[model samples]
Target: MKDKKSAKLNLQHKQHQNGHLSPSTFAKLLDLEASWDKDQLGDVLHWIRQIVALICGLLWGAVPLVGGIWLVAFLLISSGIVYGYYAIILKVDEEEFGGHGSLLQEGLFASVTLFLLAWTLVYSLAHF
Candidate 1:
């Protein structure tokens, strides 16, 4: 009986490990930021936006003519979404140190610089 119970517990743990949670999407849809008591939302937004920007930078290189416009639009839309989610949905107020503007600015700067640097490197490599 003890061995059977241990096996059952192990099976439950394995099932939990393999659970299809996808909690990020669920949190977004439900605006579950209220669960966090601190002001780390801005930081989270910053990192998320920066990652998205990096992906956009990578995609920027593979597009044809007038690709910059598309990239700019995507960046704007994504940033807007981030802002709306944090300010409206999450109800996160403006913090003194890492406020929404600061986070957005930092993220946009990093992403744009990354995109430019990547583009420059690729251009140089292709030309040389």
Candidate 2:
């Protein structure tokens, strides 16, 4: 029993020294139970939004969706996904990230810019 326990601890220590997450920590993250520092969480949310924006932009361009309705749809879809991720999936505390507003707004501007650029470029290239 002692040898087994020591082996497990040694493995974990080696993983940490190699900059790898321990098995337990990896499991927690997969289960969305891991607590993330503010900056790390914020950056994760930002990248998530960016990815969503890129995919949505590409789809909208391919489908040739236009007008205010599409814009509204983009906003709804992007924000909704981000909201669901942090609030439902991660179950993070809203107050920790300065309420829902700041969390939702992270990387929003850059994402929108990316979306518009992708939309216009794809639409012009493919449709026109």
Best TM-score goes to which candidate? 2
Error of 2 at 70 (Å): 0.9
TM for candidate 2 is 0.76
Q: Candidates' lDDT values, in order?
A: 0.60, 0.82
Question: TM-scores across all candidates?
Answer: 0.51, 0.76
Clashes of 1: 0
Residue-level lDDT of model 1, residues 1-128, one tens digit each, is 99999999999865764423335534654464445423245446656666676666555554431446766776786688677766677675658445766646645666667766665565455555
Clash tally, candidates in order: 0, 0
What is the alpha-carbon lDDT for the whole of candidate 1? 0.60
lDDT for position 88 in model 1: 75
Candidate 2, residues 9-47, lDDT tens digits: the string is: 999877664533335544554467588766666767787
